[model samples]
Target: MKTAPARPEAAPAPAPPVRRARARRLLMCRPTTFEVSYAINPWMDPAVPVDAALATAQWERLYRLYLALGHQVELIEALPGLPDMVYAANGATVVDGKVLGARFRNAERAAEGAAYLDWFRAHGFTEIHDPLHINEGEGDLLTCDSFILAGWGFRTAPEAHREVEAVFGRPVIPLELVDPRFYHLDTALAVLDGDEIMYHPEAFEPRSRALLRRLFPDALLADRADAEAFGLNAMSDGLNVVLPRAAEGLARQLAERGFNPIGVDLSELLKGGGNVKCCTLELRAPALGQ
Candidate 1:
């Protein structure tokens, strides 16, 4: 009788890739005068009472968290009349030391663009473009690895996408937003790392959804509950992800991908139709020696 051949040992499961958190220079504003006085988007309701104190408290925590995470936090003095200035991400879009100033669609936020541009000028940013077309800054224009993902059918005009491409010297892919609730692209989608993105499909038009699928096949799909919770309005420093605390489902998905998701209670700020990413403006590659 011949001895049976021994079976080969099974290979061990591969370890997940370790995520690295890169320090970022972020700009934010204190929500000292935050209010829902005007209905700019679906989230804002004048009938609903806003706790200005609570909004300030929540924003402070987020600001401190950024500092604790080894990120540089810069403050822009909030103007008295502009209640929506707290959404600093709407002020401007900075990339590779180039600044493309925002041009708001609604008159309510018109002055915010100049206010942010002033800060950049004071800080020694020379390559700044005051856009001719209407754009909502980082609110509708998000940077991927080598290109920019622009949003339209809401606040930002399609023409602004071309302006951004010309200003940043990168290809811009425009995605049309269909749902009123997800007015800003930042509200419906988030850039996790490099070209990795997560978004809610229903927020985008059918054609835009198809485009997103083609571009990022492995993108995380958020459920309605998470999307409504403003889960997709998240900020990532390559590894650590800061998002709304209500987005528990999305947090778990991020953890599975080897990310550290820091959930924060920005419910007070949500009343103003903004959250984590809305309050954060990343100043990418500021002019050296300035």
Candidate 2:
């Protein structure tokens, strides 16, 4: 039988273009009350004087930059005695209009943690799941596309991973952070988008490192200098990545991967042991169907 002329081999379907801005709505707290008054993490030293005004100015610059990029930047009122409240990402891990409230391990930030849960409640997040385990909110719970990458063994509890998985209806991969400098997942890892991540290998345990490698074969490894500069504490709008001004190596690597790295000076905030991502928490409204 004469073979029907081979149909022109069907062209492989084009891969969907990577998008930025999937995590555009952000919740930020002003360094209006930011101060390194007490030591919590290794980055903080009570003896080192903090410039609150400069911190405010730098925070404003970062906030305005986010606004200029057309992202929703919401704010939380600063309360007295909560110096670390400026690290908004530690407040809560919000997804699908549900909040996994943070149960802070540190007594200093405990109240600030309560305030975050209340904020979620007042703002119409009805399904707030109280933590049975200590979790410093988005500080350890990094939301990727269909799953949440959770880090424990330092700041957060591994049990929080199971809670996150149940509450968010997403898989939660628990990675153990071994380095004191990278106490929180945000400090050692930056989720670029759904399919890719950039992280510091030495900060994680050997098993966690291997898990990261397997889970994210396309992961970008942050250089030691960049990691030490808190470079992994970066934020992405899908296209533009807002990061520390000192992380030039990371910025270049991001550029190579087709991401626009907008470096901003968060040195003042760094005194508090956080940077751009630390100061910002992404808000995914229920309407987004996250």
Candidate 1's clash total is 0
| Clash pairs, model 2 backbone | 20-238, 20-239, 21-237, 21-238
Candidate 1 local lDDT, 193-272, one digit each (tens): 99999999999999999999999999999999999999999999989999999999999999888889999999988998
- lDDT of candidate model 1 versus the reference: 0.94
* Candidate 2: tens digits of C-alpha lDDT, residues 161-197: 8888889888888899998999999999998877689
TM-score for each of the candidates:
0.94, 0.91
Which prediction has the highest TM-score against the true structure?
A: 1
Worst 10 residues of 2 by lDDT: 14-23
